[model samples]
Target: MAHLQPKTIVIVGGSLGGLFLGVALKQLRKNLNIRVLERNPTCLLHDQGAGIVAGQDVQEFFQRHDRTHTPLAVTSHQRLYLDRKGNVIDSEDKQQHMTSWDLLYHVLRANFDGVDSEYAKAPEPQDNEGTAVYGYGHQVGDVEIDGAKPLVIHTTTADGNTATFEADLLVGADGPSSTIRKLIDPSVQRTYAGYVAWRGTVPETAVSPAARDVFVEKFPFFHSNGVQILAYTIPGPHGAVAPGTRLLNWVWYVNYAEDSREHVDLMTDKEGTRHHVTLPPGGIQDAVWTHQKEAAQASLPPQFAELVAMTTVPFVQAVTDVISPAAVLGRDARVLLLGDALAGFRPHTAASTNQAALDAMALAEAVGRIVEGEDAAEVLGEWEARVLEYAREGQRRGVEMGQRSQFGVHPLRG
Candidate 1:
């Protein structure tokens, strides 16, 4: 009888990239054990409501990893740019689709059901012993990576239990303010863009008949000027709803002045209940909402103005910039950075999620090759090279677009 060699993998941050990687690797390794450490108590995971347009890279990856819940298409094969007055400036041939963050999360979660029979007939049982596991309410306290069998992850469980686990590999799938990254390399900077975003969704039922008619009739509507706004219908829990019942999502960017910093910080209310804070949230201050209302009345379109007024809970995020050290701490062979953790891109390109999906597939292939015993570090190094090249290119492009957007020169100048 042959004994099975054990392989343990720890992923910090149970968000998109982390979960996607865990599930993809589990499906591939079949023998490696996987665990995800997510800080937010399970209750706060679904509060975010922004929508993302998945590119070919993401679409193909989701199809391969977990096809069960790929969202039903919600975009109209068109990309329209508009002006501040809600007038069209130029249109493009970009065929894009929109899906809410939560919807995508649900689809990914469903794929991890570990019950293959549902998606396939006599589907080769996913390694019954091999599992892709999720641990909620576990906050990562600190991380220390030693040579082989490195990566000591200190965590606080949901039940308030403290424990430390070690793994061969550690990934910071954590978002903008990743604690792991901070411990690994403190010099990496997260710069602010002097802007803040107020994001929220209004159900089809909440929106007025007129607003619904306009949103459904058109896919994404944009408004330019220093105040930028983008709105679209995205997949929600009840399936794609009718115009009035569809999920209408919006992200509004407001430039920050020296005195107005508090306006952005005030996104959270007093009860430690974050209505919106880039990283911290409990409750929002009264004056912040007052300022937001005035700004909406003055800068936003009539439809958007109404939508903001309609939303019961709006999230505010103070925009910040984050870029990893040119020299990521890993051996540069098997461990690599992906998504926002690698090269943080502004929202202008709407390519963040797409980038992450691309990372998952790329990493999977690299790991597959590593399993074949062909120099794990070498394979990973090559992957990092490719990621860095493309990520830097994308970042450059995003910065250009952001600058153009600020000056009202972007194609959609709306």
Candidate 2:
């Protein structure tokens, strides 16, 4: 039996996957009414701090779908490994590229707006001629899709405003702790991975001139062991900044025993405090920067030590275990899950954003098929299959990494 095509989709999360899906769906189905629900109140300030490298396929997808006329600034295109002595051990100069997260978000946002512009400029004049627009600060409290059109939804927003926007489909692109998933499948939840991640970006000036030379000489940092950190500079707000003065980003992983009581307490800076950071929402207390820095200095080799020492400011992050067992969509298949909401890859693969972009493209194609009289369920099923396959591969690798860390085996070392 042929399935009903989804005419409306509600994307819950205005981050990478949600934004890209909005633009892609609008491009594919001009009449598709799309709304993005962002938990964040404002879009003025983007918190995406660092950059990542997208492979050829991802880059090509951007070129095909994104018509924002903005060119990506490639910071570097290689991953280099160095030993504790600050000497080069191995390098994969072939597969390297640098992309700031904020830059990608800006480009995608512009492209989404371009989609609206194209709709406005459409030669045809009708309500369904172009994608209708809406962005909500929704704290999705529930998702009940058992109705005639499968009214997958949220209860209300953070400010006590009730908004029940019904769509043919509901997309769960809301990251690891997806409320949509909880509403649909409450049994599955994210568990702790028994490890924590420490991350921060420092200005190039924070490091000595010699460190600057080393960084500019290479792009992404990695190691054969499981432990690896990538660092590169991207364009900052001001253009006149020195070449290395841009943000230098890195993440370090440390394993913690189950039920380990030792942990860093979250601290608040004083009124006049110069450096301050509120840990990301939902983040658990992590190892203190001082303790983490000392651990890195002691355990890591000299080359990594140099990078850690140079990072004047650092934030601790905890790793969690989360994965959706099955991918389910509405009867009409109007909405779907993408990126971390559906599947989260460990940072080791460095494929999180790339996977999100891929999800955008794949979901667009699937929705396009449904619009052309194909079975919406089948199309979505195929999309989910491909995405889940990639996700499973990533999880397999991540699990291996977690096991190695637990057993005192260093990650990245072959």
| Per-candidate TM-score against the hidden true structure | 0.85, 0.82
lDDT of 2 by residue, 195-240 (tens): 6666766666666665665565356344433355556655444311
Model 1 Cα shift for residue 120 (angstroms): 15
Best by lDDT: 1
Q: Go through the candidates in order and give the clash count of each.
A: 15, 18
lDDT, residue 311, model 1: 67
Model 2: residues with Cα > 4 Å off, grouped in runs: 75-77, 114-129, 132-134, 150-152, 217-228, 238-245, 264-278, 281-287, 301-303, 310-313, 330-335, 405-414
- In model 1, what lDDT does residue 122 have? 18
lDDT value for candidate 1? 0.65
lDDT per residue, candidate 1, 280-373, as tens digits? 3224565666677777777776677877777666777776567675414553221346677776778877777777777767776766666556
Indicate which candidate wins on TM-score: 1
Error of 1 at 104 (Å): 1.2
